[model samples]
Target: MSDAPKAANPTGADPEANQPGLGDLRVIVANHLKRRLPGRSTMREDVAAGMSIAVGNVPDGMANGFLVGVNPIHGLYATIMGPIVGGALSSTQLMVITTTAAASLTASQPLADMPVEARTGALFVMVVLAGLFQLLFAVLGLARLTRFVSYSVTTGFLTGIAVLLILSQLPTIAGYPVLGANRVMQTLDLMVHIQEVNPAALGLAVMTIALARWLPRTPLRGFGRLVAIIIPSLIVALFHIDGVQLVRDLGEIGRSMPTPDMPSMLRLAPGVLTGALSIAAVVT
Candidate 1:
C-alpha cells in the first residue's frame, strides 16, 4: 500500500493482466493489420505514388506483353492488377509487383506450341496456376529456397534473357518479318537478311537506345526512360518514318478494363504447368 505500487501484478493473478494467450495473439494480429492499413494523413500521397508508378510502368508492361505473344493491353492489365493486389497484401511497403521480361520470355516457350486462338486461354490458365503455386509455397514457408540459388546461376540466367530480348527485337528494329522458329534461327535469319534492314527503323532503334543510356546520367534522370520512348515515338509520327512499326500495327488495343474470365481447366496441361512454374520461379 506504500510506495511499492502493489507489486505491479507480479503474481499474474489479475484477470485484466496482460498474458500470453489468445487475446495477446489477437492484439498482435490487430497491430499487424493496423500497420498495413493506410493512414488518413498519408492516403493522398499513397494514391499519387501509385498513380505515378502505374503510369511509369505501362511501357515496360507493354513490351513484356509483346514478348509473350499476347496483346500489349494484356500487359497493362497485368501491371494494374499486380501492383494493386500485391501492394495490399505484401508486408514490405516499397515492393513494386509488375510484369517482367523474364516471365514473359519464359511463358512464351510452352505457349509457342498452342494455336493462335488457344494461346490466350492457355496463358490465362498458366498464370492462375502459377499464382496458386505461389500461395502454396508461401503457406509452406518455402521462401528460403531462393537463398540456395547461386549468384552466378542467376547472373547467367539474366544475361541469357537479355540476349534473347535483343534477338527478339531485332526483327522489329530492322523492319523485317518475324521469320524464325526459334531465337537461334531468328538470329541466323536476321544475319542473312541484314542487307534488307530498313534504315529508318534502324536509326530510330539506335537513337532510342542512345537516349535510354545517356539521359539517365543527366539531371532529368527521373524521366529518362519515358523521354526515350516518347521522343522517338513523336519523331516517328511527325516525320512519318516509313517501315517503322507501332503496337497498333499488331492488333487492336483494348480501351477498357479487362473482364475476368474463367480459364479452361483442360488447357492446364503438363506443358503449361512447366511454363507456369518457370514463370513463378523467375518472378519470385
Candidate 2:
C-alpha cells in the first residue's frame, strides 16, 4: 500500500460526502446553521408574515364562495387546505395558492348541466383534481409554466370577474328576484325593473361599496372596510330586511383548523384527470 492515505471522492460518491436528496435536504438544513443573525431574523419575519396571511385568508375564503356560487363552507375548506399544500410544494414564494375566479367559473360551467347532487360531486372531483395537478407540476419541476398566464390576460379576466360579481349581486342590492343565465341579461333585467327596486337594500349596498372605496384613505383606515360592512350588516339585522328580500345572511361564524383526509382515488381518477389537465393548461 502507498504511504499516502487515499483521498475521498470530491464528486460526492464517498458516503461521507454524499450529495443531498430530498431527505438529505432536510438534514442539510438542520446541520448547516447560518452564522449571521440576519438570516435567522429573515426566517422569523417570513414565519410571522405567513401566519398573518393565513389568519387573513379564512374570511376571504368564505367570501370567495359567495363569488363562485358555492357554499361558503367549502370555500373556506379550499382556501385553508389549498394554501397549505400549494405553499409547501411551491419553489417560489410570490405565488398565492388560492381559488381563482377563472377556475371557479370554469368549474361551474359543466355543473350547470347536472343535477344538484351530481353537480356537488363533480365540483368535489374537479377541485381535488386541480389540487393534484398543482402537486404534479411541482413534482415534475414545471414551475416555469406559470409564465404563460400573462399579465394582460389576468387583468382582463379579473375585470370580467368584477363585472360578473357586481351583476350577480344586483338582485340582492335592488331587492329583486335574480334572473337570466348570462351576466348581460341579468344586468339588463335589473335595469328594466328599476321601478320595483327597494330603496333600503339599494342604500345598504351602495353604502357598503362606498365605505369599501373611501374608508381606506381616512385616519381610521385599517378598519374602514370592516366598519363599512359591519355597519350595514347591523342595519340589516336591526330592521329585518327580509321584508324587502335583501342580501343573504351569514348566520354564524364558527371557525376551526383543517384536518387531513385521504384522497378518494377511485372517484377522482377519470374526471379528476381530465379536469386536472384542463387546469394545468390554464395555469400554464
Best by lDDT: 1
Candidate 2 wrongly placed segments (more than 4 Å): 1-59, 113-119, 134-155, 218-224, 243-279
**lDDT tens digits, residue span 39-140, model 1:** 899999977776657666867888888888877778888888887887677654435787888889999899877776677788898998888888888898
Each candidate's root-mean-square deviation in Å? 8.8, 10.1
Question: How close to the true structure is residue 177 of candidate 2, measured as C-alpha lDDT?
Answer: 70
List residue ranges in candidate 1 displaced over 4 A: 1-52, 217-220, 263-270
lDDT of 2 by residue, 185-250 (tens): 878988998998888878887988898789758864545666676788888788776645422343
TM-score of 1: 0.79
As a whole number from 0 to 100, the lDDT of residue 71 in candidate 1 is: 77
